[model samples]
Target: MKFAIAVFSPAHAPSSRRALLFAQAALAGGHEIVRLFFYQDGVHSASANVVAPQDELDVAGQWRSFITEHQLDAVVCIAAALRRGVLNAEEAQRYQRPAVNLPAPWELSGLGQLHEGAQSADRLMCFGGD
Candidate 1:
């Protein structure tokens, strides 16, 4: 199976973790992940500024490592990321930021990427809330 998962909740949200776990399970079952699209509050997962409490590990960092290690297509909504101050190196330079440290294996893009992912994947999974 191929999956294009859209995660719209924050990293701390249980739904966000559920989405990640689902993806991991899918991959373990030998499925392909066409794309992992983060939108709305979910884009925060792609921000390097995310700081987890001392008692907990950084879920966003885990996500980054997972995606990068798997070499999967991970994308964060450009508009959402920008609004939340998540920028790539080029974006940081363009925005005149001092540094850029957005999550790895994630790219900033428009909704078209999500649409394309849906079309490319066998299933379009939405891990989001109203």
Candidate 2:
């Protein structure tokens, strides 16, 4: 089955870890992931500055690796990211920020990507959010 995942929790949240694990398991089971959309606080999962303790799982790193390894379409919501201070190179320069925390393989786009993912995929699964 084809799936589109929308994650709305912060990287430190258990829901974020569960979302990653669910994606991994789906891939392992031979399912196709059309896209992974990070919205709201979930954009933190794509931040390069995320650092977890030694005893805990590095959720952001794991997400990065998984998405890159699978060559998955991972998107971080541009508006949400900007509002939360998550910036890419172009965005950082445009906003006159000193640094860029979001990196490669994860694109920053509008909510239209999420809409497209939902419209195209067989299932649109959402994790976290109120």
Candidate 3:
């Protein structure tokens, strides 16, 4: 089955890890991922500045590697990311920020991307959120 995943938690959250594992299992099962949308606190997963504690698992790093290796379509919500200070180069420059925390392999887009993903995929799996 093709799936579109929407993650709304931070990388340190358990739901974030579960989302990653689910994606991995789906791919291993020969399923396709239509897209991975990171919203709200989940935008932190796409930030290059995320540094896990020494004793903690680097879920953000794992997410980066997984998405890069799979060449998946990973998107971070623009409004959510901006609200949380997760910025790409262009956005940082546009906003006059001192640094850029978001990098390649992750695209910054509006919530419309998530809507599109859900529309295209056979299933839409959302993780985390109030």
Candidate 4:
């Protein structure tokens, strides 16, 4: 089955970990992931600046590695990312920001990307938020 996963929580949140695990499992099971959309605080997962505690699992790093290794379509909501100070190089330059926390393997897009992903996928699994 093809799936589109939407995450609305930060990397530290349990739901974020669950979402990562779900995606990994799906891929392992030979299921395709059309897209992984990160909205709201979930954009933190795509931030290169995020540094998990030494004792922690570093869910964000795991996400980065997983997405990179599989060449997954990982999209972060631009609006939400901007609102939370998660800026890509282009966005940081446009906004005159000094730093870029979002890197390659993660694209900053709009909600339309999420909608398109959902429309193309057989299932839309949303995690976190309320």
Candidate 5:
């Protein structure tokens, strides 16, 4: 089956961890993930500046590695990212920001990408929502 996953929780949240585990299980089961949409606070998972404590798991790094290893399409909502101060190189330059926190393999896009993912995938699984 083809799946589209959308995560709405922060990187430190349990829901985010659950989402990652679920993705791994799905892949192990021979399922395909069409896209992973990081919405709202979930965009934090794509931030390269994230620094986890020594005892805590590096959720952002885990996400980056998993996405890259699987060659998955990971998209973060541009508006949400901007609102939460997560900027990529182009966005940082355009906004005159001193630094860019979001890294590669995670593209900053619009909600239209989420819609497209939903349309293209056989299932759309959403994790963490208020």
Candidate 6:
């Protein structure tokens, strides 16, 4: 099965973790991820500037590695990301933010990417309630 996974919850949330786990299971079961769109607070999961506390694992890092390893399309909603101060280098320079956080393995894109993924994928799974 081909899947398009859309995540909306913040990283470290149980729902978000469950979503990733589900994606892993799907992949292990011979399913393919056509796309993984991160919107709302979920965009933070693709932000490179995020630093979890010493006790917490880096969920974003985990996703980055997973997506890259699997060669899955990982995209973030630009509007949602900018709204939360998650900016790529160009955006950060344009906005004069202190730093550029979002990086490779996570592409900044529009919601249309999600729609395209849905159109192409066999199943569209919305995680953490979209």
Show where candidate 3 strays beyond 4 Å: none
Query: Which wins on TM-score, candidate 2 or candidate 5?
Result: 2
Report the lDDT tens digits of candidate 2 across residue range 8-126. Answer: 99889999999999999999999999999999999998999998999999999999999999999999999999999999999999999998999898899999999999999999999
Model 2 lowest lDDT segment of ten: 121-130
Compared with the true structure, what per-residue lDDT tens digits does model 4 show for residues 2-24?
Answer: 99999999999999999999999
Model 3 clash tally, residue pairs: 0
What is residue 10's positional error in candidate 3, in angstroms? 0.4
TM-score, candidate 2, is 0.97
Worst 10-residue lDDT window for candidate 1 reads 97-106
TM-score of each model, in listed order: 0.92, 0.97, 0.97, 0.97, 0.97, 0.93
Q: Between candidates 2 and 5, which one is better according to lDDT?
A: 2
Alpha-carbon runs more than 4 Å astray in model 4 = none
Candidate that beats the other on TM-score, 1 or 6, i.e. the better one: 6
lDDT of 5 by residue, 41-81 (tens): 99987899989999999988999999999999999999999
Q: Cα miss at 94, model 6 (Å)?
A: 2.0
Model 5 pairs in collision: none
**Residue 88's C-alpha lDDT in candidate 1?**
92
Q: Using alpha carbons, what is the TM-score of model 1?
A: 0.92
Provide the overall lDDT of each model, using Cα atoms, as 2-decimal numbers. 0.87, 0.95, 0.95, 0.95, 0.94, 0.88
Span of ten consecutive residues with least summed lDDT in model 6: 10-19
Task: Kindly report which residue stretches of model 5 are placed more than 4 angstroms away from their true locations once superposed.
Answer: none
Per-residue alpha-carbon lDDT of candidate 6 for residues 2-92, written as tens digits (9 for 90 to 100): 9999999877776677778999999999999999999999988888877778898778778888888988899999999999999998898
